[model samples]
Target: MDRKHRGACLCNRVQFEVEGNFDSFFLCYCEHCRKDTGSAHAANLFSRSATLNWLKGRESVRTYRLDKTQHSKSFCLNCGSALPTHDEHLNLLVVPSGSLDTAVDIKPDARIFLGSKAEWVDKLDCIPGFDTLPQLER
Candidate 1:
C-alpha cells in the first residue's frame, strides 16, 4: 500500500510518514495545546493505528505526558515539532496537522475549548465550537 502523508521537523532532523485520510481533524484552543504550540490554536489530525511510523531521527523523538498522566504528546525533542498525540480514552492518535509535507484537503471542521481561547483571538463566524472534544462517532 502506498503511504499518503509524509512529514518532517523544521530542520528536517526527523521525518515520519502517516498513512490514510484523517479520520477527524480539529483546532484546539485549549490552554495545554496553546502553551505547547505557542500558538492560539493547534491544528490536529486523527489517524488510524499502525498508520504512523518514524522514518528517521527516532532518537530525537520524545513524549510529553501531562502530569494528569492520561495522554502523551509526541514531538521532536530537538526542534519541538509536534508529531502524534495519544488520547487514553479514545485510543485514537492525533497528528499535528502542520507537520504534513503538504496540505491535505481535510480542513479543520471544528474549534474546541473556545471558552479558554486567548483574549486576542477574534471570534470566527461559522465554525462549530465545542468546550471539549465532541462525542466520537462509534
Candidate 2:
C-alpha cells in the first residue's frame, strides 16, 4: 500500500491530494513566499509538481505572480491562504505545510533565501541553513 497526503483551505472550499513521502521539508524566506503566506517564512513540503491535483473546487485556487521570476504561487482565493508553489525548472511542487489536513512530524531540512528572511525572525533549531538555494553537484 502507498501513503497518501490530503489537505484543504481554511473554509474547506479547496482540497487536494499528493502521493508519496514528502520529497523535502524546507523553510523559504523568499519574498514571494513571505508576502504570499503573510509570515516570516513558509513551511514548504516539496513533492512532484504533477502530484498535487485538486480534488475539488478548482476555481477557488488563486495564483499570484511576484516580479518577473516565473516561480509564481497559488493559494485559496477566499481565505488568502498559501497553497502550493511550483518550480518548473526543478520539477517540484512545494505545498504549504500548514494546509495539510493530517499531522506531519517532518521538520525543515534546510532554509533558502536566508538573506531575504525578516530581521525579527530567529533560527528554528538551526537546521541546515543556506542563504540561497542549495546547489548540488550534479
Candidate 3:
C-alpha cells in the first residue's frame, strides 16, 4: 500500500495529498528558484510514481510559468504560499517541502545550482540561533 502525505498552504485554504514515496528530493539554488521561492533556495520533492490529489480549495491554486525557462511554481491565491505542480513534459510532480503538513519519509538527496546561491547562504550557519524572536530595546 502507498503512503499518503498531506499538505496545505499557509492560509490552510489549499489542501492536497501525495501518494507513495518521492523519488527525488533537492534543494535548488538557481536564480529562478530563488526568485520563485523568494528565498535562497527551494526544497522540492519530485516523484514520478506518486499521485497528487487536491482535497480542498483547488480553485485557489494558481501556477506561474517562467517565460523563457522551465522554471515555474504553483501557489495558493489567498496567501501566496507555494504548492505542488506537475511538470507534464518531465512526467514529474514537484512539491514544495515547506508546504507539507505531514512528515516526509524522504530526505534531500542533493543541493543543485550552488553557483547561483546567495553569498550570504554560506555564512548563515555562523549566525546566532534563537529559540524565539529576541525582544528589541525600546
Q: What value of lDDT does candidate 2 attain over all alpha carbons?
A: 0.79
Candidates by TM-score, descending order: 3, 1, 2
Provide the lowest-lDDT 10-residue window in model 1: 45-54
Q: Which stretches in model 3 have alpha-carbon errors above 4 Å? A: none
Q: What is the lDDT of residue 126 in candidate 3?
A: 89
Q: Tens-digit lDDT track for model 1 on 29-89?
A: 9888898899998888876663677899989988888896454588888878888655657
List of clashing residue pairs for candidate 3: none
Compared with the true structure, what per-residue lDDT tens digits does model 3 show for residues 37-74? Answer: 88999999999999999999999999999888888899
What TM-score quantifies how close candidate 1 is to the native fold?
Answer: 0.79
Winning candidate number (TM-score): 3
Clashes of each: 0, 0, 0
Where in model 1 is the C-alpha error above 4 Å? 1-3, 69-71, 86-89, 123-138
Pairs in clash, predicted candidate 2? none
Per-candidate local distance difference test? 0.80, 0.79, 0.94
lDDT of 2 at 76: 84
Please report, as a residue range, the 10-residue window in candidate 3 with the lowest summed lDDT.
Answer: 99-108
lDDT of 1 at 114: 94
